[model samples]
Target: MRASEDAGLRDRRRELLTGARGRVLEIGAGTGLNLPLYPEQGIVELVFTEPEEPMARRLDERAHARSPVPRVVRAPAEDLPFDDDSFDTVVSTLVLCTVGDQDAALREARRVLKDDGRLLFLEHVRADDAAGARRQDRWHRPWRAIGHGCNCNRATVPAIEKAGFRLEHVERGTVPKAPKIVRPLAVGVAVPA
Candidate 1:
């Protein structure tokens, strides 16, 4: 990734996570990159849900190394092991693109979130432009094969809406200098209905 692209992702991630507070659950907590971006003052606790064993181990290590250790759970997004409305906030960064069943995962997210709880996400999604979308469709097959099940052309916004959450805010833009086929990043907050 280019420096600009990395910075863009970091900025978008931070923006989505800035005010995250109360009991928080992060799905697909890969390597715990969002651990540091979490706000120190408002956040009451951090819980991470990761299914991959290797990535879970890394997330555990990272959490232990951080100032505030986060609770880590070994689980998939669609099958989260949490009580109903357990978290005040649910977060997913660069995650929905890879879930085997994105709709199920989003529904689970809403299921675990409080009625007024917020869902914050920073995701690389399918492009809105016709030409760019065409390219994304063309590259998705090979991309999924090599990128570990990640889809390059998911309509994340509509999917989130279909999962029963109301979109409150959304910001769509490119990850600077990244490949056009997978460049549209959606950063936003949604509320459970």
Candidate 2:
């Protein structure tokens, strides 16, 4: 799934990770797709996490393959093992919509983030157009059942704001060649409020 992303989308991912510094934690690190993009200097540590066992093993293998190998943890976003204000940066890409408790996970992300930390995200969101959003609402339940708990209609930007983070910059766009109902995306960075 990661490999199939358009060149532009892959470039967007790199743009989001290239400037990161200090301790970084990547939630839902499936297959460690973003592992190779972390900047070489300044970053103290990079952590990758995934909930499922099989995905965790794959992430482990991928992590070891990177130049600055990341630490892998088998854990869910709603509950992280780290202490509060522990990390300088937190990253989530295409993972929020599927979390069992989206609010809990967002709150957890804020909790572990340092007071001056930033959260970088790239996620599919509920559409702003009424008809499009309605379609997302209608397909959500069944879509989640078959798509690994990924609902195509989450109001991700609002959820990020509601999580008590102030957006530094955010933009919405569609994934090229993907279904429209699942393509409305939000890419941004937010800092703890």
Candidate 3:
């Protein structure tokens, strides 16, 4: 993953976060990788939710050392603890694929966001072509074990739409330095419908 970041995922993260402002909530913020990439101005508050204790601890450590130190919450994406309409922006990068329930997590994100809030996401999804998808299916079991529960074949964009978000923009692409089976990517911004 770090190799992927060094290859191009870092730039993707920067792109996903551009223009983000006001109160922000980032679900599944693994190790605060996006912390330094956030714009230097306009963000009133930044909070991160990570379900894993080890990752949350690292995230908290990294957050405290940053300029706009963010608050770290130990909570699952499927069950965020924030109040409704509290955030201006909600972000999910490389996270939706691992959530136990993608639709539930997206619903939670939508619930916490303000009426005009935006969801910025970058996730590896099921491939568009049948051959590629078959490859994903064939490799998925071992990959899931190696990835610690990350699913390589989830239809995440549709799940987001099913959760009541209207996609405002989307760019189909590939994950840098990742295996082809898990490289199919979608980066997008969605607003509450």
Candidate 4:
């Protein structure tokens, strides 16, 4: 997934994270892909949280080897161990689709973010077409099981909007070489509503 995503997406991730500043928290850090993208000068600190033990260990190892170390915590997105309005930026990348509770996790993101904080996201979402959406739902159970709880047909955009974040920008596209049910993607920034 990482290799294919990088090969296809170009500089989208870099474009999204380079401008991030102040105290930042990234949910579902995975293999710490976003770790190196954040700017060296503006960022004060970075906290990466991952629920999966294996992924968290890898994230720790990756962050440890980097110049500016990030504090990695093993925790689910729905239950972040941070104070209210504690961070300046909250980031999520290719994670919302797999989160067990998308609504709860997003609420947590909003809670931990300062009033002026922004949420940056790159997520695969449900298709716009009706037939494709049905296919996504039809295959959801098995897909989720195989994809580590990922809802290939997840409605990420509406979920984000419903989380009460005032969207600053959002762009939709398709992932290359992926099935139609899992191809739709959304990338953007949002602030607390």
Best model per TM-score: 3
For 65-164, candidate 3 gives per-residue lDDT tens digits of 9876789999999999989999999999999999999989999999999999999999999999999999999988998999899999999999999998
- Per-residue accuracy of model 2 over 30-105 as CA lDDT, tens digit each: 8877887777887899988799999899989988887677899989999999999999999999999889889999
How many Å off is the CA of 175 in candidate 3?
Answer: 0.6
Give candidate 2's total backbone clashes: 0
As a whole number from 0 to 100, the lDDT of residue 87 in candidate 1 is 96
Which regions of candidate 2 fall more than 4 Å away from where they truly are? 2-4
TM agreement with the true structure for every prediction:
0.96, 0.95, 0.97, 0.95
Per-residue lDDT tens digits of candidate 4, residues 1-193? 7654666753777788975789999999888987877788888889999999999988999999877788999999999999999999999989999888999999999999999899999888998999989999999998987887888988888888899898899998877667677888888999999
Clashes of each: 0, 0, 0, 0
TM-score of 1: 0.96
Task: Give Cα-based local distance difference scores for all models.
Answer: 0.90, 0.88, 0.93, 0.88
List the candidate 4 regions with Cα displacement exceeding 4 Å: none
Weakest 10 consecutive residues of candidate 1 by summed lDDT: 1-10
Clashes in model 3: which pairs? none
lDDT value for model 3: 0.93
For each candidate in turn, give its C-alpha RMSD to the true structure in angstroms. 1.3, 1.3, 0.9, 1.3
Return the clash pairs for model 4, or none: none
Least well predicted 10-residue stretch by lDDT in candidate 3? 64-73
